[model samples]
Target: MYTIGQVAKFLGVSRDTLKYYEEKELVKPKYDDENGYRKYNPYDIHDVITTNFYRELDIEIKKIQEIKQSKSVTDLEHVLAEQEAKILEELAYKKRLLKKIKSVKEDYYKIKEHLGEFTITEMKPLEVKGEITEYAAYEEYETIRNSTENLKKAVTLTSARRVIHFDEEGMKEERFIVVRKIEDADKNFKGEVLSHPKCIYTVIEDGRFVNGEKSIDHEVGERLLKIAQDNGYELTGMAYINILLTTYEEGLERVFLEMYAPIK
Candidate 1:
């Protein structure tokens, strides 16, 4: 027989935890009234070790107590197997989250590198030839690209292409593209492109827009607009972004926008 403190020292558990196990009937120890101290026998030591093993496997305290009372090996094995499966599933989830976090960090560093190198300039509107179309809500570049591909198949001019995005009524209402000729504009382009008068635009330094990181475009554009306003430039006309490529294959390119302003 060993006192509670002696048992705790041997098992490396606190006396309070052993007391809790006793209250839960997982480990019943003898008590001595003379000292008002609890005493643990050899059988109690074995129970404590088994309870700790179950706890290490993350078995719930209630389940552990039930298992101990039943003394069923098959039931204990089932609980342990469930705990192992849960641990593996959680590990897989953590791995995926870590991968995403790494990818995001890499993108952030890349954008930071480009920020210091890019230049912003006010640009005069120029004629762009491409098919024009209306854009619906949440329409993305990939959808626009598919539309452009279909337009190319229908048109004879291989070189003419440009997409213009415009906002209307608090919604993304219109998309316009300039192709080689009017004869090439058709339903296949997915929307009608009416001639938009040339407006002032801003030009971003070449190699500013990165592929697989288009979200940076919005950040850059917003920052440029703030800079323009700070310089007392009145933003008046539609903004057009012109992407000039140095290496499309490597996603190294410059994007500049032409923002129109009323002559003050």
Candidate 2:
């Protein structure tokens, strides 16, 4: 038998922690009434050591008490295996987060690299006729492609001569294509006539199209609005994005996009 002080020294644990364990009924040592002192036997020492080992592995004290009481090797093994699986899952989740962060950083760098100095230009309101489809992003494009049958029906049925997109509320709201007739258009067609208000236009010309992603520099939009204000033009209505041409090479490695914009 050893005093609480001697047990604490031997186990390298504090006296208060041992007292806490005793209060929790996890480590009950015999008491000496003569001196009113705690006395720990060899069995108590073994339990304390085992509890400390489980605590080091981040197991809850209650769980350790349950396992200790049972002393079933299979139950303890299951707990350890479950904890290991949880650690693996957490590691995989963290890896995915890191990948996403890296991808975002790469996108930021690409945007910075491509955004050149701004230039202002004036655009005349010209009438165009063509088939127009609502612009869709990545996966949405696939859905649209399958639904529209590669846009053949949209172009043929409307007799679309030209297509244009107008940005509204951070997204392309109005997509118009100049067609022969606006009467009794199908479900996909919003037959409302749209026009741009008087505003100076900003333009950028890239020799090649940058894949499926539209190469309209939004920073140019800001510069254009400033220029329009300086040059006496009231900004009204949304800006129009016009794609002149989209060509893809046979290898799928290269794509070209020619886009123009008219801001109002």
Candidate 3:
């Protein structure tokens, strides 16, 4: 026989926890009328130890009770097998989550390295791999990306919008590019393929100077033209703006973006 406190100390559990188990009918402690307290016998202590062992496996209290009440070996085996399956499933989920987290963290660091730098550089022509959402609104972009279920969870907002038109009522219709960086161009892409030549690429950050007025794409393009002329590089082809960073919550006001224009 043992008091609740004595058993709790031995099992490394609180008296309150043992009391809770008793309340849940998982353990029925003998009540001493003369002492006016709960008394745990050898059997009760064994039940508590068994309960604690199951709890270590993160098995639900009710499920642990069910396992304890199981009479036949087959019944016990069935419960154990179910728990094993659940643990395996949980392990797989956690592994995937960890991999995704690591990838996103790496992306954050990579993007951080590109911040606050403006220079003329030559970038390899990237293949527009994914199915581009043509003339999509911000909401439409989200709906389309969410449908695909391939968007990185850590990534927010989306890719560049080939701003065709913008008025007081916001964007009428604009092409949105879900840029997929790939070595070989995937031929399955249904969207229009527009690749940048090995030309001057200038980046512009979204700040007070740049906002969605007459399309930041045009603004950056014009600025790139000046840069090209000043640096003795001929400014020819149309500009392609690349959205670096943004949030769905922060419309145009608190959004972070960059413009990439092809210069001769």
Candidate 4:
């Protein structure tokens, strides 16, 4: 038998921790009437060591208590299997977050070079398999914001968020698309797949789309239309504006977008 302090030192824990385990009936120590001191048996010390080992695996105290009550090897196996599953889930979540961080960093740097300039280029086809939902302009920002969370949650992993736009009777309408790579076979989002054909696109960084500057839109839109027409290309559909970056300041949204129009 060893004193409470000796048991705690051997287990690399505090005396309070042993007292807590005793209160939970996990470790019981005998009280010495002669000196009025608590003494833990060797078996209790071993149990404390085992508890420490389980904690290193992030097993909760409740689960550890259940494990202590386990009667068979099968019960122990079940507990370990559950722990493994939780670890896998945590790893997958962290992997997705890391991917999002890396992508945002790359986009952040890439857009700095394209600010306030329009360039005509050949854009490759976009083959995305995920969900698409349209949103009204300047109407119920909260509704859209909630939907964004739902969409992001639905996707197991996402690489891009594409917002395509069109005008209907002078009202701006947007299509929100959240897509993952083809390799993400375990993707949970069950939405329509979007396939954009390769096209000659006039890509530019314009804040007027989300910032609500109609004057800038009218001027830039007309100039872009003329540029396409002069270069022997006719715009055939609504523009697909893939926002490269967006920043919010004082409740105002500013976006740098790359617009694509199918040309004939």
Candidate 5:
């Protein structure tokens, strides 16, 4: 028979840990009443080793207790299966997170490379919905905040400027809007889809905020229009502004946006 100290040393665990296992009734060593001491036989040592094995696998103490008391192999198999399923789900989530990290890093590099540079390019197809005229409570806002899938597919907050309208005079209208990517597979989707064949694309920085609310600087709009006129591109009275990145510096929110002004 071995003492608690000898068992703990052999198992690479602390005596308190062995005492905790005793308290949990996971391993009950024989007690020497005359000597006022505990004694662990080889059988008790084997139990401690098995308990450590289950712990290394991250099995909870309660679950390990259940496993110890289980009479059939089926019961043990069921617990193992549950742990396996949970691990697989976590692994899949981490893989998706890694993919998103790589994509966002690439976008940051693109923003740095193309800031303030203008080029005529085709805009990606967009699906437009309701307009956000002012700051107030709305159903779409709540849905996007609460639903994970909808939030993931919400383009307006991540990559797209809600909406921008330009007429012959200049930028006529600008406001936030509820918008998402057009799903080709969804037959039920009936939102208006827009496509621009040619557009003057450029990235602009805006950091102006009014009354703690986000607002776009109109000067950027004038500059874009002037660039189009100077380059001899006929205006199409509309433009699409997409967001590339947003950052906070010195308590100020700065937005980096990509604009696509349609040209004839």
Candidate 6:
């Protein structure tokens, strides 16, 4: 027989841990009335060693108790199989999360490289699901939210607005719409398609706010027109804006956007 301290030292565990095991009925140490202390026999020490072995595998205390009291090999096998399946499921989720993180990092780097730079490029066709407007009701907002939630790939949250008409004064009417790349769209989808074969693309950083809402800088639109004329490209009067990201600093908000206007 050994004292609690002796067993704890030999097993490399605390005396309190041995006491806790005793409380859990994992190890029943013999109490010595004359000495006023607990005494651990070889059997009690063996039980503690087995408990530590299960703990090394990260088995929960309650589950370890179940394993200790298991009557058959099949019962033990079932519990272990459940744990294996849970681990595999968690691994899959972690893999997907890692992939998303890597993709977002790549996008951030790309934005930094092309920020505020203008170029002539062709964009793939997009399917407009619905319009996003300042005056939209809560029910309309919920409908759009539910629709995009089912998509497997990331959806473009904003396409800014389409220029309905342009005149000497300025744009006559503008309609804001939500769009996604055509490839990711579902079959039987009935919506307008926006395709720009050749367009002036540039990223704009806006920090203006009005009535607690972000407002785009119209000066950028004037600049786009000027640049297009200098390059001898005629404007098609259609503008498509894809918001890249938003950041806040020093109680101010900054919005980065990918702006495109069709050229003829």
Q: Number of the top candidate by lDDT?
A: 5
Preferred candidate (lDDT higher): 1 or 3:
3
Model 2 clash pairs are: 129-161, 129-162, 129-178, 130-160, 130-161, 130-162, 130-178, 131-160, 209-257
Off by over 4 Å in 3: 118-174, 178-204, 207-215, 223-254, 258-264
In order, the Cα lDDT scores of the candidates are: 0.53, 0.53, 0.61, 0.61, 0.72, 0.71
For candidate 4, write residues 168-232 as lDDT tens digits.
23325545554433334545545555444545444355454454664344444464566666777
Q: Evaluate residue 241 in candidate 1 and report its C-alpha lDDT on the 0 to 100 scale.
A: 40
Higher-ranked by TM-score: 2 or 6? 6
Cα error of candidate 2 at position 97, Å? 5.5
* Clash pairs, model 4 backbone: none
Against the hidden reference, what TM-scores do the models get? 0.47, 0.41, 0.64, 0.66, 0.70, 0.63
* Clash count (model 4, backbone only): 0
Residue 230 in candidate 6 has what lDDT? Answer: 85
The candidates, ranked best first by TM-score, are 5, 4, 3, 6, 1, 2
Task: Give model 4's TM-score versus the native structure.
Answer: 0.66
Judged by whole-model lDDT over C-alpha atoms, candidate 3 comes out at: 0.61
lDDT of 5: 0.72
After superposition, candidate 1 runs with Cα above 4 Å error: 118-264
After superposition, the stretches of candidate 2 with alpha carbons farther than 4 Å from their true spots are 94-220, 224-264
Name the regions of candidate 4 deviating beyond 4 angstroms.
Answer: 1-3, 6-10, 119-133, 136-220, 226-237, 250-252, 262-264
Q: Which segments of model 5 are wrong by more than 4 Å?
A: 1-23, 27-58, 126-139, 145-156, 168-170, 174-194, 208-214
Pick by lDDT: 4 or 5, better one:
5
Give the 10-residue window scoring lowest on summed lDDT in candidate 3: 163-172
